[model samples]
Target: MALRGLPTPLPGLAISSLLLARPAIAHDHHGGSEIPEGQTVSVEPLDTTLWIHIFVNMFAYGVIFPIGMITKSRWHVPTQIVGSMLALLGFFLGHAHGGREFVGNNVHGLFAHILQILLIAQVVLGLYLKGHWEKGINGFIRKLIRPCHSIIGKAMPVLSWTQMIFGGITALGFCQGEYTGQCAAHFIMGSAFIAYGILLTIILLVGQVWMRQTGRSQEFYDSAVIAAWGCVNTFTEHHWGTAWVRNDWQHTSMGIIWWCAGLAGIWMSRDRDGNPKRNFIPGLVIAITGWAMSSHPQELMVSEATHKMFGHTLMAAGLTRIIEVAFILGDKQSLTEDGRTWNSFQFLPIFLLYTAGFLFMGATEEQMLLVAGSDMDHVAYILILFSLASLVFLFANMLVHMYDRLANPTSSKEMNGYTGVNGRPMEEGRIRDAEEFELEGLTSDGEADDEGRGMLRRSQEGHRSQIQGVPLR
Candidate 1:
């Protein structure tokens, strides 16, 4: 038999009641339950506030999604959609669980939060699919699109920073008398956002400096661009997880490590005037240092859970790095008489190595999680690691092929004696001789037919006599 009637919690009323009841229980002391005690919980009012913030943020993100679509950068479009959805989820959760006012009720604050999500999403998508996007777009569109994209792209990171600033303002204003623990969490996450924002700015500046110092070589420029993107991607991911306290720091650190490795790789491959090998040593050091630092036990002492999470992240990052390095090595250019050929097959070993490392890392993480009875976290780690591994493998293979094609030189057309645009080559020596003779004829003849004829005859005779070493008649 169906139950005749069951009472369900009211929205704002329930929350207000709980808030009113919380202080009374504070003195009673069962050490407090997971849910805050005390408060005259009201349902309707709190629900209204929650809905307002949710609606505004969603509206802002909705605007951004269309903007992304119109731009036609496939990579960015997906991320925009995904981020919007995530923000929507966050908004709903905040309202349902009671913390809507902490996000602010003002239109401006809502706009800023939306902008923040949009910018972060764009940066992540751009970096993750950098090379692919560059290749996927039509050549004409690439040329037409890139300038506009660059301007907007450059502004995004700065906009993200601004959004963070506004978020801080909102946090301060809204959280004043609210839940202290939640407020503290917001503050910490906000700080991470700020830090990563600064890092992204620095990465852009460093790329500019590297470009200025290295000249306009495409390879050098592309490498720097890739590295800069990597930094932005790493930061974006960290920010995505910031609201969730249980995120693995090791994963964030590994991303940072990859960013630094890319930077070092770019620096190493730059054309130095002398002793280029010296640069390689330093570059290698930087890469190794990044990996070591990322995997270090700084947060492990905090808890066994943190240690396992961090360890999994670091292992995944390291394996990914190895795969990248392998691709680079396999794509090394080899010079031949016909031109150059890239023996990309050389990377096969490294590719296998990466696969093995990824498998081993995944297994180790699973084992650790099993021992700790944290299956959910372990599963998350495995998924992330697998996703990254698949990406690395796919890209590495594609890059190897691309590098080979780029390195292989095509034969130039043979020059014919005749001259025309896209037709035949005109010899400079022959052209100059003809010009000189015409000038002499014009100077000597001076537009008099008979005189010009006589001068031409004399010139020919003199030239012949000089060649034969005898007087001409």
Candidate 2:
């Protein structure tokens, strides 16, 4: 499913080429120092300090910042402050590393500086917005900055994700020279998987209304992107003037299938009346891609194992998506919603995609080699990636839940012990209560009046018999 060894539009490829083009004898004022022209540098093993820095920063940006944004209240301030402090500490630790001495302009370090500046700007904006000024130019300025603050707040986590990927690659000194193109393909496509999973979760949790308003099935958007990406992959995967190798053929053919399947998906996403309709073409395409990737030949056993797991996870994601759309949801959007609760079965595919993304990202040759050199086996490495995915999945769900709680606060009915989806109260005893009182006001004609009188008389007779102490059978 990836371009394998083709160049991409990402800037990382250029930076990597610069880093690997020359030897590390002298530092390039702006770029990092290079290794000797013919000498090769082995991948640097991660030390305890580096690991700590990674975890601290990942937690701050991935967990705390997202939660802060979701809260968007007084709690937001403190949560972000804590996250910022942790991130700052991680930044310092990154520079203080002794295991790897990156000379000249370190890509990871440069990105960190940019990230920190953005973080500072975000904090400043938040503080200014908190002042609550009014009736002055300050108020107007605040109004202008409010949206900017929110936009930055939302963008920080995504930016942090990019920086984190940079850190991983930089730390290992991987993705250089010929591997740069492959790095771009793996990271870009992996991030796409994660982004898709997140988008689906958002739509499942809180965007149902917006989705319904779009007047198009979810598959429409999915197919559109797939088609667009496939078009790019088809043209760029192989150089037109060069001899087409096996890898190029595989990649280009996969791209061909993607665009073909995507078009079918778009066409089937509507009914005869032009109403939105669900289709499984997207899922089927994903499954076929996964199958191809699982059987893809690799030079190393470690790589083979990693790719197999990644492919299996992807296959599972696609299959689960099909099951969710076709069986669980009956080819519909969603199920009955008395509350903002999702069917338990719905999360399976999202989490699988998340895991699949991590697996694919970790399957890079350098990363697999690192794993092979470590004490851990492929199974252990895979499990660690799965664990990371689970944590991310938890954070995503929690953030979405926080947003739902804020967007749809408790109503008077809910405050009085009634609660359900879309702020509607539960209908537990409503029907029985309505039935019991239904005939009370029906006194329109003779038959109705006679029936009512007969009921009254029978009640009176029963009371009299009870007063006489007689057993009325």
Candidate 3:
């Protein structure tokens, strides 16, 4: 995962060779069909109104909601509330016009319904906060509220991306019939979804360690399952023991490596001397995720090169994390928060992706480039510059959050104000640790049996503080 020591020649050769030999790559990867020599796929206008609705859906749910979650400003709530309503409206309209046909499959329809429920639930949570009261909800439901909030909250981005990708895949191309061929757009974005999933797994594991959850048999169980899948994906993607590993394959291979490292940590943790060393796995995870997206074909091309630069920046941050973890653990200190706190250095990669995502938006415009440097397009370059401006905006927002955390920090008594995952302020004072979040049927005070709900340790006065009502009128 460390870019400095790892040789790049293998991946470089793989990319170059793939480009030169793509004709023979067996077009069986995506589907049996192939695009006629010079044709390409594109976004459609089921008319202007449909096009506008979907983009608005994408921007509101994918962009604005996530940005609010990342920055966690109080001002973000009003905007997010508005965006949620708009996104829900858009979902209904889009579904009526486009997604209705897919209901027979059950998969897409199920997810669509889940997303709608999540949106309604989020709106309810926002209003509850605005009300500054929780009498209408139950104590246990309130205790489990943040975790529920977090699951749906974190899911919105992944769910949005899923819907978008499938929507694109299922829709007829603007200029053609069904697009049953390989889509570069789908591949790139789909890989990001996988990458984000792995990251959350690692972050949750690391968070548990910092909070002193030493008894982690369940944690190991989860890691073992994820690693097993990674191992399966490794072979499935053709990345094992091969001389030339494709960049996409490298991603799965690294997932395998990360899982192996995690398994090692789990085994070692039983030795009583391995507590300080258990964090190496997560550090390596960050490093791998950082570089996994770097080794693609257009590594040095226009915005493609910029994307690689973005990848390396994340790699550097990963290396820094590794070093920091070593230093802190060596001195018998706690592990740093990953993505949950305003004070976390863990937010770095998230920021990198958002800013870099815009750059990649135009990187996909490579098909528009003409022959030779003389006829090349400048749109991607302009977008790359716009991405940098976005970086500045994000940087400024991060600075404000850091400043706020310093200026108006929360105490253990005010656990509700911490805004658990994705900035959804908890309705109940029950702040469950991320470790046992998945096992819903467990008490926060103790582990749960299979049939029981996870009992979250609701704060008495420690969990509740004086509430001042804000007039919604």
- Top candidate when judged by lDDT against the true structure: 2
What are the candidates' C-alpha RMSDs?
A: 20.5, 13.1, 12.8
When 1 and 2 are scored with TM-score, the better candidate is 2
Cα RMSD for candidate 1? 20.5
Error of 1 at 462 (Å): 51
Clashes of each: 28, 7, 8
Best of the two (2, 3) by TM-score: 2
Alpha carbon deviation, residue 203, candidate 1 (Å): 16
lDDT of 3: 0.46
Model 1 CA deviation exceeding 4 Å by range: 1-100, 103-150, 157-473
How would the candidate models be sorted by lDDT, starting from the highest?
2, 3, 1
**C-alpha lDDT (0 to 100) for residue 195 of candidate 2:** 79
Candidate 3 lDDT by residue in tens digits, 1-473: 11111112221232222222222222221333343444332222355555766788877876777666544344457667777878877876764552212212222344567678878887776555444344556545565665666677777766675556445433432111221212333234323433443353344333444345544433354345546545554554443566664554565566567568657756643436544333455445546755765665453355456546546655665575556445533422243433233325544444544444344333332322321244444545545545654654454455445434433343323342565555544433232322223232233223345344423332222333422122111
Q: Which predicted model would earn the best TM-score?
A: 2
**Which has the higher lDDT value, candidate number 2 or candidate number 3?**
2
lDDT of each: 0.38, 0.73, 0.46
Which residue segments of model 3 deviate by more than 4 Å?
1-52, 55-85, 88-157, 164-210, 214-226, 239-259, 268-271, 274-276, 285-300, 303-307, 328-409, 412-473
